[model samples]
Target: MYADPRRRPVTFFVGERVYLMMLMWKGVIWFGKRGKLAPRYIGPFSIGQLLNDQTVVLDLPAELFGIHDTFNVCYIHKCKVDDESQILSLQDLKVDMSKKLLEGPIRIVHRKVI
Candidate 1:
């Protein structure tokens, strides 16, 4: 799949793991971490469900990545810097529509091997 107009998707094998993601409505910035705690959730979802004020709707588990129901914005970070595309960086986060939305980065931290 295309990773926007600039970045390309990393090569993956059949056994490789990937998370389904899309753009988020909110802005988030991430800093390199050293502590080891909590589950490592990923993605912004490829398909997003229409949100409502009364109740919250979510993307389908099977249709989307069924592994995780929700994700934290900080899970993904840009390793390299490029000309900004109206996207929100952790350094500068704002909840606006005109700005481009993107998925959280896939990260592997020191955790017990299952």
Candidate 2:
């Protein structure tokens, strides 16, 4: 699960701003706001992609500069979004991220072009 900012990213770091995680597993989005921690899922890219690139094409966020320590999932705080969907959003997104990311039946579709 993404949006949680705690879920693993394809890449990430500490003290960074918002993240645009590309999910590779099926699960729930859990943020560390509640003083909880989990393995990262996607990445720690800077807010640049979401800020400059209209399509949210992120490689790595500039703010992810000084942090290093990264880990895989072990502990986490579940979010409101269901983990049975392909997308993780604050809205009504339903899909299995764990299954889809491991499976080959997923394709990424965005709302705009980069």
Candidate 3:
């Protein structure tokens, strides 16, 4: 009874695009280093098949061949259309050899004397 309100049904259809939750493992360089800024999910892959009501098979790329294609619905999220304004271009960013931002803020947006 307590969990009913918090629980929501999730559904997916074949050919629909969705994001898959990514798991980090020690010594797995394929997914890159895990850190505070590491990506939590990857891909907007198409649904290849439905194994059951709660399980799905994704059409993952060849690079992800090592990982199982099947995933539980809990680990999948529907992909929404991309927002143009929300996208950032890498060319606009200025980084040094170490990949740290080389430029500071152009102007302070707020300042307090207190």
Q: Name the best candidate (by lDDT).
A: 3
Error of 1 at 99 (Å): 37
**In angstroms, how far off is 68's CA in candidate 1?**
8.2
Q: How high is each candidate's TM-score?
A: 0.18, 0.18, 0.67
Mind sharing the TM-score for model 1?
A: 0.18
Residues 32-80, candidate 3, lDDT per residue (tens digit)? 3258756676777889999999999999889778778999998998888
Flag clash pairs in model 3.
none
Per-residue lDDT of candidate 2, residues 9-86 (tens digit): 433223333334323344544432122233253332333332221233234435444433232322212232333354
lDDT of every model, 2 decimals:
0.35, 0.35, 0.76
**Least accurate 10 contiguous residues by lDDT in model 3:** 83-92
**Better-scoring candidate (lDDT), 2 or 3:** 3
Q: Tell me the tens digit of each residue's lDDT in model 1 across 8-61.
A: 544322222234333332333223222352124333223243233222233434
The better candidate by TM-score, 2 or 3, is 3
Instruction: Tell me the deviation in Å of residue 81 in model 2.
Output: 21
lDDT of 2 at 15: 30
- Pairs with backbone N, CA or C atoms under 3 Å apart (clashes), candidate 1: 21-45, 21-46, 22-44, 22-45, 29-90, 76-104, 76-105
Error of 3 at 9 (Å): 0.4
